[model samples]
Target: MASLSFVNVCKTYKNGLTVVKDFNLDIKDREFLILVGPSGCGKSMTLRMIAGLEDITSGELWIDGQLMNMTSPQSRDLSMVFQSYALYPHLTVYQNMAFGLKVHKVPKDEIEKRVGRAAEILHISHLLDRKPSALSGGQKQRVAIGSVIVRQPKAYLMDEPLSNLDAKLRSQMRVELAKIHRELGATIIYVTHDQVEAMTLGTRIVVMNSGVIQQAASPNDIYENPVNKFVAGFIGSPSMNFFPVWVARRGEKICLEFGKNKLIANEICSKRLVEDGYVGRRVYLGIRPEDFHEEGPEEQKILFDVEMKEVLGAEILFHGRINREEICVRLSPNVKAEPGERLPVYVDMDRIKLFDMDTEQNIIYV
Candidate 1:
């Protein structure tokens, strides 16, 4: 296992279009870090740079304590499992797993021992003699992972390795991959555009955009307190509802006005936002689907008319509009809802986020 670091990493194609901008992150040994972003957002390019498949335009990449700016991919002591399971069509599973070692002229007995153990770990021992054509997509994926496992490198780099499977199989493999990581204690860097995969598989996640690092933190932290509007909307399903609001002095108390309602901000939000040179200026009220509740007794939550409800398994997502601004609430599955109807929804005062409309920076409550 090894720690990986990228210091001031940058990547530019031949057209001089920059894909990464002073990207920096520290991945601890044995840590499962995920790089998540929309496609063409430099996540794959960053991984390729680490794997030495693409040369770094500038800056250094490090593994453990070694400077690997010019190191060959093979000398990086890492293994990669890609989206397509590149298993040999003619070779049996055992042979495909052992091919790397065989090419290096590793002893035949040692190769068998490593392959056997990996197959057992991956639970593919029974299918060792099967050809890739004979295996299910999931089984083939497991074999691809097992092929890497047998090598037992310092770290593993996976680029959307489970993307090709069905949802059920992807769910199953998520568990298996976690188990494999724990059992082997190998560091792993995974890249995926799927937020669910990033949230579930990563101990820490780095969210990127436009070739820049937006936020890097644990899943829980990023979910609960995203650094900006992009991270806030990108990390959650159904996305967060954003609407324009203006801070105003109504009567005597300071409040944020949305449409016809004067929703009071938390004292912290009011203080930071009011003093951040934007008091009485336009800002965006950030609210998550789950943050809005059907019952709100507080004097602060904005009221809305129910527009629609999407029942997802055990939870219901209530879509509403307040002063023409769209809103959402996560309700229990038992709560019956209808569209174009008036329903009282509460915006959790303590769970609110305020972002500068122009800068998109979180107006951190002091």
Candidate 2:
């Protein structure tokens, strides 16, 4: 395993379009780091730069403390697994896994040993004699991974390697990846647009957008305390609900008003707003779908006209409107809900998030 670092790295096209801006990160040895974002968000561009497939407009790339800004991809001591399983259809699984070693003229015995070990680790030992055409999608993927495993490179770069699999197979491959990481202790850099994959597979995640790094932290930290509105909305399923709210101070108490409902701001939120001199200022109120409950005290309740109901097993997502703003509430499967009806939903005050209206930044969390 090896440590990787991107120091003030950047990528700009000849036409003057900058895709990655002053990118900086420190990847520890054996760390499984994930680059996650929406499409066209520079996640793939960053990976390409690291793999030496693209030129860096400026800055440095380091691997194990060696400067690799101008190093060729072949000399980078890294292996990349592409989104498509790039296996030779004519070769058997064992031959495909051993191709790289043979090209480098490694001893025949050594190649066989490495191929056998990788197949065993990936649990594909039974399919070694089968050609690529005879293998399933998952099996082909494993062969692609095994092809790199035999090289014993310093790090592994996987760009959406599980994207083409079916949903159930993708879920299975996630577990297999974690197992592979444990057994090999290989440093890995993974890129994907799937938030669930990012949350489950990455030891640390870097959230990116429009050529900028928004947040880089553990999955739990990013989920509970996103740095900005984009990170908050992107990380959660069904997305967090946002409402235009006005902050007003009444008799030494700070309160938030949305529509016809008002709730006292928690101590942390109140203190931040007060210090920022935001009394009577409009801000965005952020809350997760799951944080809205069907049962609570009347003081915490807010009424909304349910517009749509989506039934998901074990839970239901209720879509409603409040003061012309759409919001979704996740409730228990047992809760009775219907469209075109008014419902009193309670906000979990302890889990509330507040963001600045103009900046869209989390006030308390930041």
Candidate 3:
């Protein structure tokens, strides 16, 4: 229900350590935007700035067309949920959820109506009489969220709200959060270090590193067309495999050669390499684990020395070496292969990515 804009925003400490560098982004109304990166990557710091918990060193912070850089947290009219539940231990679920409205002196009947609606939306109606001590971890989290829901703020800010729960609870909460987003149609800004959460929950993802924005795109674009080596290696589960290979011309064909092996490039990749005059130079060959296939043209096969295997239900991940460089391949579970065996696999030419050796940027996208 609200839109936010950060125009050339920055955050720096008194000790002169800058955490956010010229950050600029526009968040649309009713959007679920995720800020994702590793620890100390400025994701949480960015969220704090929006919540009025941190001062912006420079630039503008606007909310629904109002300048908010000088605004107090209370006047921001935004609700924030933290990793800790922070519920009052002595208050019942209904009382805890109604506390905020009571402090603001809302009508008693109106408070009751809001609490009932929130509890129903969160599926915690039956637990309204229970105290924080008697609720499960997930239920406690729901109560914390319900407290914010009653406020009905313009936007919601969440900083890893599900991180404190167990893995199973985290997965369950993920589904619950998705449903809440749809039902409320409220704008949400979420921050987390978990890529799975970023991929599944976000309508738009912003990837950051060292106080800089690396890439901002949808899940499919980030997975299929990463902007650089760091993103290509970070977004996926098993991560993309990298190899130092030479781009060379062999007769009338363009091929990538590493050690004693060679693989042909698809027409699109080959055209870029030649047009960019990289005929005889070193480049990084990037391939995802799932792009390796057990069936392909015989001439495109390479001997992969399997060192270990992990069976993950529907598929198997083979951790092996190709010409002394470590590699991981995800294949169908039906494919039979064992440790210490030479297994031949082919790379999907059309699905492969190439990166610049010096700049580390994706060559195809550059």
Best candidate per lDDT, number? 3
Any idea what lDDT model 2 has?
Answer: 0.92
| Error in Å for residue 17 of model 2 | 0.7
Q: Candidate 1, which ten residues in sequence have the lowest lDDT sum?
A: 294-303
lDDT of 3 by residue, 309-364 (tens): 99999999999999879999999999999999999998898899999999999999
Flag clash pairs in model 1.
Answer: none
Error of 1 at 196 (Å): 1.2
Q: Return the clash pairs for model 3, or none.
A: none
Runs in model 1 deviating more than 4 A are none
lDDT, each prediction: 0.88, 0.92, 0.92
Q: How high is each candidate's TM-score?
A: 0.95, 0.97, 0.96
lDDT-wise, the better of 1 and 2 is: 2
As for TM-score, the candidate ahead, 1 or 2, is 2
- Show the lowest summed lDDT stretch of 10 residues, model 3: 295-304
